[model samples]
Target: MALLERITGPRDLRDLTNDQLVTLAQEIRASLIANVSRTGGHLGPNLGAVELTIALHRVFDSPRDPLIFDTGHQSYVHKMLTGRQHRFDTLRKPGGLSGYPSRAESEHDWVESSHASSALSWAEGMAKGFALKGEPRTVVAIVGDGSLTGGMTWEALNNIAVEPDLRLVIVVNDNGRSYNPTIGGLATRLHGLGQQLSAIRTDRRYERALARIKRWVNRTPVVGEPAYDLMHGFKAGVKDVLAPQGMYSDLGIKYLGPIDGHDLKSLELAFEQAKQFDGGPVIVHAITQKGRGFAAAEQHEEDRFHAVGPIDQVTGEPLTTSSARTWTQAFGDELARIGATDDRVVAITAAMLHPTGLTRFAKHFPERTFDVGIAEQHAVASAAGLARAGLHPVVAIYATFLNRAFDQLLMDVALHGEGVTFVLDRAGITGPDGASHHGMWDLALLGLVPGLRLAVPRDEQRLQEALQACVRIDDGPSAIRFSKDPLPAALRPVRHEDGLDVLVEHGDPRVLVVGWGQFATMAVEVGNRLAQQGIGVRVVDPVWALPTPKALIAQAGAHDLVLTIEDGGLAGGLGSRLAQECRLAGVRADVREFGIPQRFIDHGTRAGILDDLCLTAQQLARLATETVLAGDPEPAPDQADQRG
Candidate 1:
C-alpha cells in the first residue's frame, strides 16, 4: 500500500520507519503541489511544514495533547495526516474543507488560530485547564518566529516564564519569513541563529547531550546550595566556551535548537527531550526553509510563493490573467505616483509590503517606506508618530488586520489628531481565505472611531482620487477601502452629484437605489433591469460611507421608496447609516437595505457569497421589488415640502 493512503491518523505515523516517514514527506509535498495548483493556498508554508508536522504527530498525540498552531496557514500537512486527505479536491470550496484550521473540521483540530502569535496564549489557557482537571496531558504550541514579532507572543511568553506548572511545549518554526522576508530585530535575531545552526552540522545526538548537561548543571542538590551555585557557574563557563542561547533564554524560557527542521529524525528527538522535561517551557527552535521542496517556490525572492492563485502545476504560471489591475495593484501604482511629488508621502506595512500594495511605493521611495514585521499595533501607533513629524504617512494593510490596531487608531492616531491615511485592501467579502480573512468589519468599526475621514471608492479613477484626497486632509486620521475584485471599466458613471456620483439612471426614479463602493456598478445594473419592469431607480456612490451620508438622505426625501446596497457588515454599516439619516431627515419613505448579516461568513466564491448575502443586483432587484410591492411607501408631509 502507498504511504499516504495507509495513514489515517497520527497513531499510524508512529509505526512508520525513518525511510518510510521520509517517503511520506515527499508524498505530502507532491500532494500539496497537486492540490494547491487547482485551488490556490499557502503553498510555500505547507511545503515547509511537511517534516515538522510529521515530527509533531509522531512525537505527541493531538486532541488529547492539544496541539495548537499559530497562524494556521501552515496547517495543511496537519489536515492531510488527520484523515481529510480524500477531500483534497474540495480544498477551499464552499461546502468542502476550509483554507485555515477550523474547529468544526475535525477532532484533531482544536483551536481556530488563524491570527499570528495567538497559539502561545491559547496553549497557556489549555495547559491551565488540564492542570485544573488533574489531567496529565501535554500542550504543544507550534508558533512561527514571525509571530514572535507581535506583542501578544511576548505577553504569553512572560506569563509562561513564571508559571512553571503550565507544562507547555513550544516549537518555534524559524522559517525566517512571514508573508515577506521578516523585518525588525526579531527577524534579524532568528536569521542570525539560523546561520549559527548552519555553521554546525545537523546533529541531534550532540545537541541532546548538551541539553542534558545544561539541565543537570542547573539542577539543585537540595541541601548543597553553595556547591550547586559553584557547579552552575563552572558549567556556564564551560558552555560559554561551547555556546548557543540568546534572547529566548534571557526571557526565562529554556532555549533548545537551531536544529535542522528538515531532518525528521533530529526534530523527533528534540521534541522527545522537550516532552520529557517538566522543568519549565522549552523553545525548540528549528530552522526551516519557507518553500522547502518546491523549486518554483524556493527560488522566488519576495515571499517565496507565500500565497497564489490557481496556476499551472509544472510552470507555476497563473491559469487566468487580467489586463486590468487588482485593487492592490491599483493602490500601489497610485501611491507611487503620489510619492513622486510629495517628499512627506511615506508608506508603511506590517511585513506585508507586496500584498498590501506598498511594493511599488516602496520601490519608488525605498527610503520613505517601512516594513514593521508582523506587529499591526506598532504599525499604526508608529504611523501616528510619523504623522506628527510633519509627514503624510499612508499605512496600507488588509482591512481585517486593522482590527488588531483599533485601540491604537482610537487613542494614538485619532485622539492626538494625526493626519495619517490608512489604505485598506480587501475591504469586504474576501472569499476563499474564510471568516478571519474577510474585512467585513472595517466599514462599521471606522464609524465608531471619532474624527476619522473615510472613503470607499467604486472605480480605479475614484480610488486614486480618494487616496490623494485622504492624504491631503490634515484634520485627523483618514482611510480609503477598496475591493479585491477588478473594477469593471464598461460600467462608467454618467455624472457626479453632491458627495455622490450618479452611475446610471432611468425614468422618474421613484425608487432611488444607492450603492457604496464597488456595489454602485451592481446598483446601476439593478436600476437598468428595474427600468424594464416599469420601476424607476437612480444609482449613486455615497463616496465615503461615514459621518452620515447627508446627500443620500437629501436624495431619499424626494423619492417614494429608497434602497441602499453595501458589501460590508449590516450592523452600523453604510445601509444602517443611510436609514438613520433618512429618518432624521423626516423622509417617511421605506428604506430597504441589502448587505451581509452580522455573522461570520464562510469560504466560497465571491459570486456565491454575494448571492447568499442578497448583495447581487438580481437579488437586490427582487428583494426591492418585493418590499416595494408589500408596503408601497406613502410620502409624508415633509416629503411634499422637500420635493416642492
Candidate 2:
C-alpha cells in the first residue's frame, strides 16, 4: 500500500520513520500533480508548502492548537494529511472540496482564507481567546513574504508587541514572489545578505560606535580600510555573530532563522523550538522556492504556475486556448493604446498587475506603473494623491478587491473629487473561485458613493468607449465594470434616445426590456422569442447603468410592462435602482427585476449558477413573457414586417 494512505491524520505522522516520511513527501507531490492537472488550482503555492506543512503537522497538533493560513492557497498539502485524500480528486469542482481552507471541510482548518495578509491579526485574536479561556495552546499563523507588504500584517505585529508573553507563532514563508516576484522594501530586506542584513533592528548607539571605530581603524593604514570593507562586505556570515536580530526582534517578536523551508528535518526543529518559546510572539523565517517540485513551475519563476486551467500533468501544457477575446484582453489592449498618447496616464495595481490587465500598460510605460503590494486601501489613496498632483492614475483591480478600499474611495477620492478612473475586471460572478471571489457586490456598494458615475459596458466596443469616457472625466471618480467572460461581437445601437442604445426594437412596443452590462446580449434572446410569440417588445442596452438616464425613465413610464436584468446583486443593483427611480418618477409600469439573490452564492460553474438562479436566456425569456402577458398589452400599431 502507498505510505500516504496509511497516514490519515497528524497523529499517524508521529509513528512514521524519517525514511518513510521522505517517501510520503514524494507520493504527496505526485498526488498533487495528478489531481491538479485535471482540476486546475494553486499548484505552485501548494507545491512549495509540502515540507513546511508536514513539519507543521509534526510539531503542532491541529484542532487543539489552531494553524491559520494568510492566503490559504498553500493549504492543499494540509488537506491531504488531514484525511481529505479520499476526496482529493474533487478539488475545486462544484460540490467538491474548495481551493482555499474551508471550515466546513475539517476541524483542522480554522480560517477560510482567500484575501491576502490577514493571518497575523486572526492569530492574535485566537491567541487572546486562548489566554482568556485559560487554554494552554499555541496559535500558529502561516504568512507568505508577499503578504507582508500589506498594512494589516504590521498592524497586527504592533498590537502583538504589547502582549509580548502570548503563545503565538507566526511562520513567514519567504519564497520571494507573490504572483510575480514581490516588489518594495520588505522583499529586499528579507533577501539581503551579510552584516547589514541584521541591521533591520540594530540599536542607534551601537551603530554610532561601529561607525566611529570603522573611521579610526581606516585612518590607521591600508590594512584597516581593506579590513573594514572586507568585514562589511562579508555580511552574510559575520553579521549574524554581530547583529543577530532583525525587524521582528525590534517589534518585540522573537526571531527564528533564514532556515531552509524544504529541509523537513530543519523545518521540524525550527517549529519545535518556536513551540517552546515563552518570551513573546516569534517569527520563523524559512526561505523556500515558489515551485519546489515541478520543473515547469520552477523554470517559470513569475507566478510559477500560481493558477492554471486544465493542462497535461507531465508536460504542463494547457489543454486548450479560448478563441474569443475576453473583456480583460480588450481592456489591456485599449489601455496600452491610451497610455501611448497620454503621458499623464499612470497605472496602479494592488499586487495584481497581470491579472487586472495592467501588464500591457506596464510593458508600455514601466516607469509609470506602480504595484503597491497587496494593499488595496493604499492603492486608492495613492491614486487620490496622484490625481491631486494633476496626474491621471488608472487603478485596475478586481471588483472583489475594490471592497477593501470602500472607505478610501468614499473619503479620499470621492470627497476630494479626484479624477481617478477605476477599471474593474471580473465585475460579476467569477465562477469556480467561490463566494468571496465573485465580484457581485461592486455595483451595489458603488451606488452609495455620491458623484460616482459607474458605467457597465455591454460589449468590447462599449468597454473601450467607457474607459475612454472615464479618462475624460475631470471631477470625482468614474469606474467601468466588465466581466471575465468572453467578449461578444459589438452590439451596434439601432438608434439612441438620450444615450440609451436601442439594441432590438419592435414595432410600437408595449413591453420594454433593459439589459445592463453583459446581460444585454441575454436580453436580446428574450426579445427575439417574445417577438415570435406575437408580443411587440423593445430591448435597450443602457450605456450608463447607474444614475438612471432620463429617456430610460420616460420609456418605462410609457410602457405598461417593463423588465430589467443585471448580472449583479439584486439589492441596489441596476435593476433594483432602475425600478426604484421609475417608481419615484410616477411611472405606472409593472416593473419586474432579475438578478443574483441577496445571499452568499456558493462555488459552481458560471453557466450552472446562472441556470440555477434562473438568469439564463431561455428561463428569463419565459418569465418575461408571462409577466408581460399578465400586464395590459399595447395595440399592435404599424408592425413594420416584424416577422423576418
Candidate 3:
C-alpha cells in the first residue's frame, strides 16, 4: 500500500504495532520530504515531530479533544492525518492549503496562530471555558522549546500553574532552536546544567555515590527511620533541583519526562501517563532532533530548513534562480553600509536575526548586534537603553511581531524621545502564512505613539534613503515599513525628498493620488490607465507617511478628488490621517480611502489577495473614473430654477 494511502485517520493507526508505527513514521517522513520539496513549506520542524504527532493522535481523540499547535509551522503531520492529505500537494500555494493551522481548514485545528508562545494562552482559556461548562475534554498545547523564550509564554505558564484543575497538557518539543540559537552566558549555563543532568542519569560513579550516601544514612542510630523517611524527599528534591522541575514544579504544575520524542513507544507511554494525571497543568518535555531523517536539513546551520521556496528533492538546491533582490536583502545591504560608515550605529532583533536581515550586520559588527531571544518587549526597551547611551540603535523586527512591544515602544522609546530606529519587514499583507502573520495593524497601532516618525518606501532607492534619514534624526523614534515585493521599474529614479513628490500632472482640475510605500507603483499605474480614459490624475509619493505631510496636504486640497492608497489597514492609517488633515484644512474635495479592510484576509497569493481587495490597477482605474464622474455636478439645472 502507498505510505499516504495506508491510513485514513488517527483511528486507523490505533491497532498498529510498535514496529508498524515506526514504519508509519518513516513513511510520513518520506511523504513530507517529497511534498515539501515540491511545494516548499516548513520541513525540519515537521520531520522532527512525525512520531510525536502520531503518538499524540493515537492517544487522544482529536476534534473532540483539541490539539493546539504554537506557531503552526510544524503542523504538517497533523494536517496529513486530519484528512487534508489529498490537498497537501498544494501546500502554501495561492488559494490552497495554508502553511499554518486554520480552524476553517479542519475540525481538528482549534486556533490558527503564527505568532510564537500564544498557544499556551489559547489552551488556558479553552481549558478554563471547558471547566466552567463542566465539559470533559482534554486540551493539549504543543509549544516548541524555542517559543519558551517569549515573555507571553511565561505569563501563560504563571496563569496556568494557578489553575490546578484546568486539565491542560503542555508538550514542550525542545529541538534547541528559535531560528539560530545564540551563544551567551545563559546558553552556556543551560548547556552545563543539561550536561550535569545527563551525567547523573547515565554515569554509574555518580549513581554509586548517591547510593552510598543513602545506605549510610539508613544505617544510622535513632536517625534511621527518619533518614529512610527523608530518602524519598531527598530524591524528589534532587530531581527538582537537577531538572526543569524547578521552573514549573514550584508553580504547582506537574513536570513529567524529558522523553525521547522520536521513539514512538516512549512517546505513547508518556502520552498515556500524562492523560491519566488528574490535576493542574502538566508539561511533557520531549527531546527531539530537527530534520531527523533528512541529511541536508540536519546539516543546515541556520533554521534547519524552516521555510524553503522551491527546491530540488535529491540535491536540496533552490529550483528557481532569484534575480530580483528581496526586501530583506535590501535592508541587510543598507544596514551594512550604514554600520561601516557610522561608529555609533548598532542593530537589535528579537531572536529574528536572519528573518529581519540583521545577520549581515551581525557578521560585519558582531559586537554591536544584539539578539535578545524571542523577547520583543526587551528588544524595544533595550534599543531605548542603547539610544540613551548615545548609540543609534536600529531595532529590526517583523511588523506583526512588533505588536508584542507596542507598550514598550510607546512608553520607553517614543515618550522619552529616544533616537531609536525601527526597521519593519513584511509590513503588509504577507500571504501563505495566513492572517496572524500579516503585518496589517502596525500602522494603526504605531500612529498612536506620541512623537514617533513613520516612513514608507516605494522602492529600493526610497528604502535606502529612508534608512539614512531615520538614522540621521536625533529627535525621536522613527519606523520605516516595507513590503516583500521587489522594487518596481517605474520607481527607479524616485528620490526620497523631505516630503511627497508629484510624479504626474494634468490640467487645472487636478486629481491627486497620494501613494505610500511600494503601493506607489500601483498608484502610478492606475494614474496612467485613468489618463487613457481622459481622466486627469496626479501621482504623489510621500516618503513620510506619518507627521501628515503638510506640503502634500496643501497639494491634495488643490485637487478636485484625493485618493490615498497604502498596503496597511485603512483604520487610523495613512488614509485616515490624510482625511483628517483634509477636514481640518476646510477642503471640501471628496477624500477617498483605499487600503485593506478591517477584517482579516485569508491565505492566498499576494497578487490574488490584492486583486480580491480591489487594489489592482484595473480595479483602481474603474473606481477612480466612477468617483471623478460622480463628483462632476449638474451643469444647467440652476438656470430653470433661477428663472422660476
Candidate 3 segments whose C-alpha is farther than 4 A from its true place: 178-237, 240-244, 490-498, 630-644
Candidate 3: global Cα-lDDT? 0.80
Highest lDDT model number: 2
TM-score of each: 0.89, 0.89, 0.88
Candidate 2 — which pairs collide?
194-235, 194-236, 195-235
Q: Tell me the TM-score of model 3.
A: 0.88
Tens-digit lDDT string for candidate 1 (414-445): 99999999999888999998899889999888
Ranking by TM-score: 1, 2, 3
Q: After superposition, how far is residue 503 of candidate 2 from its true place, in Å?
A: 1.0
**Deviating ranges (above 4 Å) for candidate 1:** 178-244, 490-493, 585-589, 632-644
lDDT-better candidate, 2 vs 3: 2
For candidate 1, the TM-score is: 0.89
Q: After superposition, how far is residue 268 of candidate 2 from its true place, in Å?
A: 1.0
Predicted candidate 3 versus true structure: per-residue lDDT over 1-644, tens digit per residue: 86557676878888888778878888889888899999888898999999889999999999888999986898999998888888889998877898988888888889887778889999999999998999988899999847888888899999998888887889888776742333222323353454345334433465478678878878899988697778867766876555655666668676656667787876776777667667566787677778889888888877778778778876678898869888888999999999999978999998789988888889989999999888999999999999999999999999988889999999999889999999999989988777877899999998898878898988788789889999987779999998877666647424434466766655554678877888888888888877887887788887788888888777777787887788988788888887788789886556677888777788788888887777777777777787677753332221111111
TM-score of 2: 0.89
